[model samples]
Target: MRYEAHLRARALERPQHAALVCAGQRISYAALADIAERFASALVAGAGFGNGERCVLFLDNRAETAAGLFGTLRAGGMFSVINPTTKADKLAYVLNNCEASVLVTQASLLPVARAAAAQAPSVRHVVVVDAAGELAGHEVPWDEFIAAPSILDPASRGIDIDLAMLVYTSGSTGEPKGVMMTHKNIEHAATSITTYLRMSPDDVVLSVLPLAFDYGLYQLLMCVKLGATLVLEKSFAFPQKILPLLESERITGFPLVPTMAALIVQLRNFRPEWAASVKFLTNTAAALPPAHIARLRELFPQARVYSMYGMTESKRCTWLPPEELDRRPDSVGIAIPFTEAWVAGEDGKPLPPGAVGELVVRGGHVMQGYWRNPEATDKALKPGRYPWEKVLHTGDLFRMDADGFLYFVGRKDDIIKSRGEKVSPKEVENVLYALPGVREAAVVGVPDPVLGRALKAILAVEDGASIAPRDVIAHCAARLEDFMVPRLIEFRDALPKTNTGKIRRAALQAEAEGRELPGEDA
Candidate 1:
């Protein structure tokens, strides 16, 4: 069954149950179901999109955004959620690449959406959810469309293989490619996570991540599937306001990135009561520093802190359980049910325990392929026969322990090379973060004339802490060899981050030219 069916089942089971809570708004399961059905009907009756069609959802974290996502699923169409902060060029790329027929966005975004849609002729309809307005040459005022009666169209039936959401990811080059996730893929991801986490029906999840990111999107779906409550937020920039919400709403599940976790653990007067009722605290998007892990464990002693590893290619591969967290603090944990992780060396041979190699995943949760990009898809879905099943080649590096626990090293592309020697940026970043007064650190390889490539570290200092580049370099020198030490270091107010809260190494590399990187011990 599709995610929408799960919502309907929940509505039927408990009509009055709170399904979605965004800011001050509360939507019951029944009300949310009806709105989704009505919105789906509007697309079928008003818009000219049908089964297997795609719609672009370009709104922030609001009630309408959630409705539009589920509505597309129910209408037998794929929903592509565009990042609200997506610039015009990227937006144009996704709309044209996906051949989106309809775009559901807030009124404030109509002007930008219309501008981007102008470049993509396939987009025929633009529906605005907020302040009503008319675009020069498009259908606007989304409310007018949804007011139409719900249609019981036979085509609305969604099966397991039907596409539910088409999430696009940035390619190695320009123009992001779409990742098609069917209902079964999404359901399996949600069910497996909910089952592993042991989420209860009374759990309330505080969603501070963007729905455009699949990891964040699944939090909402899992909540609906398990009859839990979702408290949505656009961002976590304001921890002061968010801390109270977690307490007031009695949030049981909270997921965050390493950057956000660092901030929350260091907040002034941060108390256990801030997350007193929270049962689970999840970390993804980026690996958490071992120091930060200890701090979080101290703060949320009652909560089960989970460290999960995944990418857009496969919804999820492995999740480190809270039980093993203290013992194997560095491990990414065991693979989820129905999933297998085999670390292969450069020669494509499976590596034994304690040997690091490329991490590959085989499971139903893997994406079908990159949308309309056969070459890229073929590269990622490297054909591997495993008992009548295919596996996905995740470009991540990992290692397995003696007990079959997996530990993440770094991305294949993220590894820095200097003088024909490879260095893991995560290791350098972790060493920097271990130093007192260091808040966050990102390591990148920069061009060098002598060594061929040089290492650089960007440091973000903790509030009110005095730490210089020399101090950081000295700390790394004590822990690492001369080659592993960053040759150059620069202090930043904040590091550049992706929408999912991961440090963007590509962006950091682009900005590292001519600035005299910190470490050069040659």
Candidate 2:
């Protein structure tokens, strides 16, 4: 079923319930539904947006972002959300690549939006939110854009198989690829995830991750499907201020990545009682260090912690149940509910337990394909055992335990080759995380004449902690094999990360190779 139908159903059943809360502004189910319907009508009547057209949203985490998303879906158009921090050139690339017909953004970002829209000829209209003065000929203030009479006619123009969203990847290796997801694909994923999390109408979710990241986007989508309240925040920049807001909102569910966890664990004055209302904690993007997992449990003794693994190709692949955290803290756990995950050898045959291979997933949640990139799409989606099926071949390497729990080994390309032996960066990083005063750690291979590729460990230490390079190397030498141990150690104030909080290893590798860093401009 279409996602907007969930909002409509919730509005009919619980009109007065809070659907979204951001910056002290609360929108009720009925109000949000009405605003979305009005916006959809405006897109169709005023802007002449045709069925299956593309509407791109370039806004921060706010109530209007939600409205723009649902409205585009209701109007029978696909929607794509660009990171607000994106520059003009990359933004223009996305607009032209998708051939977007409309662009919605706030006045605060008008300069960049205007510049990008100028280069994208396909963008026929620009809807400006929070405008100050008269708009340009192609621009319309949000109020004027959504002033059309509410109409429900456009919602019936599409079927479940139609495209719903075009989520762009972070593009660490090359140009970003748009992942195409259909309504049925999204619905299945949302249903499976919420079912595993045991979500209900009374649950209040606090989201700090960017909406452009599918991990963060799903939090909003799942809450809407369950008729739960969502509290949106721009970022976790100031955790001290967010603590009180969490308490005041009585947030029950908190979603985070490893970067946020590292920041929280380092807060000197943090206390467990401050966030006692948190009923559950969920983490992905990267595996939370076992130390951080233990610390999080100490801080929120009442909350259950779920360690998950996924990529943009499939919304989610696996999640470790809270009850199993003690037994398999390192494993990403079995396949998420309603999905099947297996480790496949290079020949595409399933590997036995304890063997390392590529992770393959079979489920309806897998994306249709990458937009306008058939070569990459074919590489990712391959023939399954059945003649009619296609399964997603995740490039990540993993090993399955005897009981079927999966442990992540690094990415296939990310594996370090040193001293004629293959080494998993995650293995070395995991050891580094166990060291005292190490806040974050990343391992990459640098060119070496003798060893072929020398292992380098880049780290960020906790504030006021004394950790020298020799100390880190000595610690690794004690726990790791000689070949697996890092040959070089460098400390930085912070590791560069994607908007979703995953470390940009490719960026670090580029710096090591003395090359221009990718994504620095965009």
Candidate 3:
């Protein structure tokens, strides 16, 4: 089924049910549906947007963000949501790349959005939400654009196979690539994930992750499919303030990344009961250390912690069941429901257990390909078992245990070779996380005349804790082999992270090699 149909069904069934809660504002299902339909009519009838046209949303986590998403789908158009913090240049790149016809943003972000929109000549309309005054001839205020009353449901002109969303990845190596997903792909992913998570209409989810990230976007999709209430937050920058919303809203599910997990465990005055209402916690973007998992369980005694692994190419790959957390805390679990996952060697053949190789996935939810980039698409999608099918070749490295549990080794490009020996950064970072006072850690390979490449350990210490470079070296020396130990150690107030919260290893390597880094706001 198409995603917009889910909202329509929910609106008819439970018109007064709370569909979205953001910054003390509650929007009912009927209200959200009405607004989305109105905006969809405006896009087609007023703004002259054709079917399958692209609309880029550059707004924060507000109620209007949800409206814009469903409205685009309802209008039979594809949508791409950009990170609100993105600068003009990168924003222009995405706008031009997708050749978006409409740009939807808030009045507060007009300075950057307007600048980027000027460079993207294909943008025919700029709809400013919460605008204070009359807009330019080409731009229209959101309320004024959707003011006309029209049919709630337009004639169906597109099918499930049509493109639905474009999720742009953070470009650490070069320009960002937009991952293409269809309505069927989204439906399958949401169905499989919600099935495993056991979501229902009574579920209340709390999401602080950005909508630009696929992992964060699915939170809204899954909750809407189940007719659940979603509580949106701008960010986890201030955890103390978010803790209260978790309690008052009685949030049943909370999604997090490793960075947020580290911050939560380090909070000095944290109270266990602050998260007592949370029934389950889900994690992705990066694996959580076993220690953090233990600490989370201690804090939310009644909640179940699910450790998951996924990327932008596919919505998700694997998820470790909460019951097996103690047995294989390091593993990212098995393939998600209805999905097939396996490790393949360089020959493209499946590898035996305990052998490290690239992870391959086959499922309905795998992305179609990168938008307008066939070279990158060919590299990522390869021939499947059948002649008509292509499977996703995830660049992530993994190894399966005897019981078929998958452990993330590192990315294919993230491996470090020193003294003619290959080293997995994840392996070393896991040991660093075990050390006292080490809040966050990353391992990168630095060029060396003698060793070819030497390992470097970069870390961030816990709040109010002190650990010298020698102490970190000494700690690694005891836990790692001679070649695996870092030749250099550096401490930073914070590690460079992608917009989605993954460590920017390439940026760190560029800094070590004295190279200018690309714009990371994308």
Candidate 4:
């Protein structure tokens, strides 16, 4: 079940089916499979990058990015996909930390790629897509890469648990950390999702998520395994242009986050018929507030809406069923196929249902470890679980109900303390978002004289909508209790977000404390 195995299977089973669509270009399964193989050959023989080397892919959501990923795997080398928005300093840290030997990037990103490479002496070559330029010491034109004649080495028969990819995460502490994933780990995740989602060759998926994220990477693997059609959209900025394509192409499956979900429901003149062509609407990355969930149901009443939960440490842990929307609307649902999870107490002992504790998962989808950080690896993984012995201890806290449904609380670090009462920041943020005229809101704990930490709120209002800071605080007073309501409010045009699209509360707290000034946009 390696990546190429899925590619080969799809090529034989559904060669004529569209394997990738972007802009106006469409590629069949056979064509994609063939290009990946050629790209792999070029890496090994033409460029002398073989087994054990790591190649960093710095590109956006494009067909060539997918090609570079599978091609690296096919060449018996581990790969890491970088975020397109990563700047010089952070990008240099990841390259140097992983000791990447090669970099594969699109033409537009080559300048940044070369700058990052300059800081890491381990990098031997640069592979550029559609651009030719000498990068001081190393450069190769990616335009002629696949067309070049290069010998393909024998496929790796190594243990399936061998390293295949180094997926870097936004390090909350400082620098980003790379999470090592095996071929088996990737395959198991893809298989588990495809089975439960009931994906088939008939499913046509239009993906807007980036390939660097685990959630987005799984879409590619699932499509290959199920022999389904995949349309790789760059972004979800223009719903007007994208919605028609969804109907015209009859796209049946889509994975979106709450941000995109909010925008989709806001589309003018949106009809059920436009989205009726899609059979499944999946969500992840962050928890969808109950209010947003209700709105999604109203928009796509006929489509099955799946609320899933997972992290980079493990691909996906659980999924709430569309049928259980009414009964357990708040729960994240049972463990995904071949995965096992449980709540653990403060002492690290397992807890039974209804106990609020850390959620730990054990499965094939669990990553091997952080690329080179043994300390962080030891903290995250443990022994004695299912699928694999290595267990992934997710830092977020959750509680399970009698029927095995998981309800997410705030992150362990995100909890606020007021008069000895532990309050969830997410709870306050959710209420703030529900207020009229508010477009986005973030809650955080700030220094206080009487209490150890006081509740603080940051709000972003929609254009032309008016609301005073006191009015916003008063709105929270009506919904939340005296201690739970935020004592201070700050208004801004936008909230700071992580690369993966979660609100950056730490940054807001820093801004509140005057330790740092807000960004120009703010």
Whose lDDT is greatest here?
Answer: 2
Report RMSD for candidate 1: 10.6
- In the range 1-522, model 3's lDDT, one tens digit per residue, is 678889889999999999999879999999998998888998988888889999999999888788899999999999999878777777899999999999999999898889999999999999999998767778889988889975544556589999999998633233668899999999999999998888889999999987876777888888889899999998888999998788889899999877678788888888767788988999875567778899899888888899888877788899999999999988899999999999999866789999999999999989999999998889889998789999999887899998999998756665564543346677678779989898889888776533546789999999989888888888777655455688699988999899899888778877776777787733
Native-to-model Cα distance after best TM-score fit, residue 456 in candidate 3, in Å: 10
Error of 2 at 414 (Å): 6.4
Q: What lDDT does the true structure give each of the candidates?
A: 0.80, 0.86, 0.85, 0.78
Off by over 4 Å in 4: 132-137, 385-388, 414-522
- Clash counts per candidate, in order, are 7, 0, 0, 0
| Candidate 1: clashing pairs of residues | 487-518, 487-519, 487-520, 488-517, 488-518, 488-519, 489-518
Overall local distance difference test of candidate 4: 0.78
- Candidate 1 has a TM-score of 0.80
Over 142-250, each residue of candidate 4 has an lDDT whose tens digit, in order, gives: 7677786536755552557779899876443434568888989888888888888888889999888778777777788888878888888877788877777778889
| TM, every model | 0.80, 0.81, 0.81, 0.79
Candidate 1 lDDT over residue span 354-437, tens digit each: 998998888889888888899888877876654565578888788898899998765566555453234667767777888998
